[model samples]
Target: MTTRTRTTTVTWSQANARRLDRQSLGGSGSPALGVTEAVAAMLGAHAQVLSAAELAVGVRAPGVTRAEVRSALWTDRSLVKTFGPRGTVHLLPAAELPMWTGALSAVPGEAARLPGDARMTPEQVEAVVTAVAEALTGAELTVDELSDEVIARTGPWAGDPVMPAFQGMWPRWRQALHLAGHRGVLRYAPNRGRKATYTNPGTVPLPGPQATHALVRRYLHAYGPATPAHFARWLGAPRGWAGQLFEGLAAAGAIEEVTFEGVGAAWVAAGDTAFPRSGPRGVRLLPYFDAFAIASMPRDRLFPGAAGDRALAGGQAGNFPVLLVDGTVAGVWHQRRSGKRIAVTVEPLAALGGGRVRELERRVARLGEVLEGTAELTVGAVTVGGHA
Candidate 1:
């Protein structure tokens, strides 16, 4: 005789409430986690735009200033800025670079799928990766400078055209740059001028299946009660591969299946099913690529009606800043800095209660403090996605 494990069941609201707490967006009432803790909580914030990354951290960790976030990245070396999931820049704790890099590198590259004209020989790819690691160690170099060094070390074959873009040809060697970052060999240097630069984060690469497993656990802990498909989408992994990983984890009892109302069975890290039913506590102004905005899925629940259409474009979230009232995205917002003043405009999908508006104002004030300026809030209809 055998007994079957019972799957936990929850409503979307229940899961989201826990997700809010885990993401550190449960409102100020939720204890303010430190910068490192917050980044680790959400795996890593989406950081394609550095400013968006700064604000994403600021909103979750109360009293955190943008300067302080920069200090953590450059001065203290507590946070590492590098290319991460979906081949986008992200801020991961420096201590955890090995795990992230190892996991990311373990995923197979799509070299075979590239057009014949664009594909680099495996030998060429390896040489470029090695050259990048060598050139960036112990010093920061701009892309142009690094490109020159790679060309010098690996021969002209490394610089062949991968593809032609509106700007120019994307080089073969450049394809490995993000791979180099993911393998823990390189990271972004603080912008000294208009050009982007790279540096070694001073960590050795540790590639393995365990690292991938660790990443799966970390992802599920922060954004789980989800399916392998969800994990694949989030990490940009191949669907079959992600599904196998999820299956193995479940067989090992590292994760358990949960059934969410209106959503089918999904996996969450084991012992992660008890989510509080309470909604979030305060209003929040989330910048572009805020982890909460992008990480949460079946997004219609988070972005009902026109809110989804406004905040997301072409199935990508974070084209515009989001206004979170209670636990859901209530509207969209944008800010323009004019010297010492930041002019902010909020475009709510529906009229907000007077108290909620005031709470949003307080959030705006916090942004002002983060920017070291006076932030003025104006209520109006914003043409979302028009301006940066």
Candidate 2:
């Protein structure tokens, strides 16, 4: 006789609150984690905007200043900045670099749709990766410096400006930059004034064949009871491949299927089906591209009702600085710095009561502390557009 698979069901509110708790955004009772610890817990912090990444870590760790976050990345060498989930810049815990590199390297490279002239052949990609590793060894180099070195090592074709960037074309080798990073060839080094730099991170251990499986479990722990499609979206992997991965895990009893309210079928780590009896309650100010806002699934649930219209940018998370109330986005906000003071403007979907108002003030105060500035709160229209 075949055993029927059991599906556990949960309310969206329960999932939200559980994610908040798991992410250390639940409340004041949450422990003040260290910088690396906080980043590791969130899997990684979106870091395209350095200031926002600092705020992301600061909010979760509480009292970890922007300077300290930088220290972890550059001085302490406890965190490494590299291309992370969705092919975006992120600050990930240094110790987990091997696993991340292994898992990301395993992701099938998306076929570049660029014209034949603009794309690098598979052999050219490998050559560029090797050159990048060799060029950055024992020394940090700025983009231009790295480009010159890469060109010298791989001939002029590596420096042919063909890949379009912001307003101009970047070198063909630049296209393989993220791939090299995922292979543990190089990482972001401390900036020289305003110039970004890169350096080889010595040697990273090769990940076991189960590295991808390990990452799947990690993702489910942080944002579980989620569908394979959610995992695909988060990792920027192919949807069918993600589904197959989840299916394999289920077959091995490493994960189990579940029914998420309003979300239909999903999967979570096996035997890990508990949810908090009460939903989370509190106020949180998340900066641009904050990991929690970006990774949580069923965007409609996290940004319920009007929040979907107000907080997201064209259905993409992390475009706006979000205001979280009871584990769901309830408002949008923006901040501007003048000298040592930061002025915060908020536009809530609904009126906040006296208690919540006080909580919001406290959160703003903490944000100021994290930024090493004095912050003033104004509950009104946030006239600013979504950040780039």
Candidate 3:
């Protein structure tokens, strides 16, 4: 007679996937900035500010300073401010911004909608369009060059001061660029002219019929097991459009779908492994808008109670840099310096201890050198409440 025993293997949750992004991307995944360079590729062209956000979002680490941003130049993930989607400055992967920008503007007249809150008329958009067409008639130019040409031709092209102004134009412009990226019209290239410049994709090939399909596939590889709704939010596309991209990829055998607890697991790559079961816990000093908290479309799964209020606190602004402990969003963090030294103030939902505490401090110390001055740290009370 024989007796039987039962055993089970557990997989990680969507929440765990977020943490995996950190490990996979943080300097381990890509060597040239190589694979990791994909981080910039996925986000499109980014700015230091957005890079900070990228860290918060788990695409990169936070407390990164301007010097560090500049350090990314050349390699694979350098800072190239190409105009796409919203004519905004995105701190994107230097290599892929062109494809991304081209995809965003794929269809003709696609950029006509939204335009801006000012709602520039078609004629107005056309004027700007004409200016762009003329400027890129032969070759690509840097944002400064592009702006110079545009302003020289039309007086002012809107994004004068940069940063904040550019942040606003992402609606229509981003859509246009996203569509354009799908078609391969524009591509990223080394500028040599102080800043990197973007030129016409000039006959490079991109994924076919599955245009958005190819793009979204990368999204999953980088930020997957996500829902259509979440895809829609991150890519800045409509839910229906997101669904189309999702299905297109799945249909093409580009990805695999699994149903998990929250929002129902949705999609991932063909051979990707679900995370291994997470154990007790730990602490992490993540950046604002960090992916750990904001990866999913709904935003509620990981941050159950107050994700909405806290994330939107800056006026529907965006997520702040977050702190994590034991597989959940713990709170937020701020990095300050006293002249030659750096300090990290972490506010947590619970008092972090032992391993988690030491771990966060080490991570912060490493990030600090990659940030301001000499490396240093200072913890603020460890409030068990949350982001105070």
Candidate 4:
């Protein structure tokens, strides 16, 4: 007789509710204490746009300030800003760099050819990565300063144009920068003026195979009951590779397959269960590249109908600050600063009850305090997603 496999069925509402709870967006869990804890809890906070990353933590940590996040990155040395999943800049706990780098290395690098048919030879790529790591080991240097160091370390060849793009000439070292970060050797230092700088992620043991597995488990812990494709998209890894990893984990009994209502099959970490059915969540203002806003797949469910059309551009999520009503994207919002006041404007796709609107105002006021300004909210018309 064959032993039959059992698959748990989860409802769409249940899955999303659990996700919101895990993401710390529904007030179900204790708030993280500071940037380091906040970034660790989310596995990593998206940091491609530095300000957006700060806001993402502020919303989840409650009472966290931009200065606190900055201190964590530069002063406290508790968090490190580095190229992470999808080759995107993310803020990760300093000590966990090894695990992140190990996992990120599993993703293949971008194509070697640049726009002008200028190709980076494998040796040049390796040399550039090494030079960047050495150049940033303990010092914080701006882009131009680092470029000078790279040229000194690896000769002018490292500074050749790898591509001709709007950002001017994309250099060979620029291509290797993300790769160096993924290798756990470099991170972004806090801005000292108007210029961006780079630094080492502090000393940590280089990770091994176990680190990659740990990274996968961490991803599922924060955003699981998700498909392989979802994990692949999140990591910028190929779907086939993600699927293989998921299958291996399943075979090892590290995770179990589950099916969601109106959605297909997904994997959840072993012994994990959905949250109990509960009342709806409150309104929230999430900034651009907020991790919660982009954590799951079949984003249509999160951004339904008109919300999808309005909140996503070219299938890209996280370009705009989102208004979440009851755990789903209901609108898009923008903010501008004038003197000591932050003027917030919301454009709802559907009616937000008077009570919720007031609550949203409270949240905005809290955000204003974090921004060190008084927040003034103005309800307005619905608009498409993207920075205003």
Ranking by TM-score: 2, 1, 4, 3
Give the poorly placed runs of model 4, Cα more than 4 Å off.
28-33, 110-116, 202-208, 382-385
Q: What are the per-residue Cα lDDT tens digits for candidate 1 across 1-388? A: 8998677887887777888887778854566788888888878877777777888888778788888888998899899989888888899999998889888988867536567877777788788888998999888999889989999999987777776656888777887788899878889998868887899876765666788888888887777778888888888888888999888988999988889777799878888777886756668898887777777777778887787787777667777788887778888898989899999999988898899888889989988887778899998978656323
> 143-226 in candidate 4: lDDT tens per residue?
889889988999877778765657688666787788788887778887879888888764453554577678778887777778
Residue-by-residue lDDT tens digits, candidate 3, 96-135: 6445644555323433343245354555445555555566
lDDT (0 to 1) per candidate: 0.82, 0.90, 0.51, 0.79
73-167, model 2: which lDDT tens digit per residue? 98999999998888789999999998898889888877786789888888999999999999999999999999999999998998888988998
How do all models score by TM-score? 0.95, 0.97, 0.67, 0.93
Those runs of model 3 whose alpha carbons end farther than 4 Å from true positions after fitting are 1-15, 18-69, 74-79, 83-88, 107-127, 136-148, 151-210, 279-281, 291-293, 306-318, 381-388
Worst 10 residues of 3 by lDDT: 170-179
Predict model 1's lDDT versus the native.
0.82
Minimal lDDT window, size 10, model 1:
379-388
Provide the lowest-lDDT 10-residue window in model 2.
202-211
Instruction: Give model 3 RMSD, 1 decimal.
Output: 7.3
Return model 2's CA RMSD, one decimal: 1.4
Ranking by lDDT: 2, 1, 4, 3
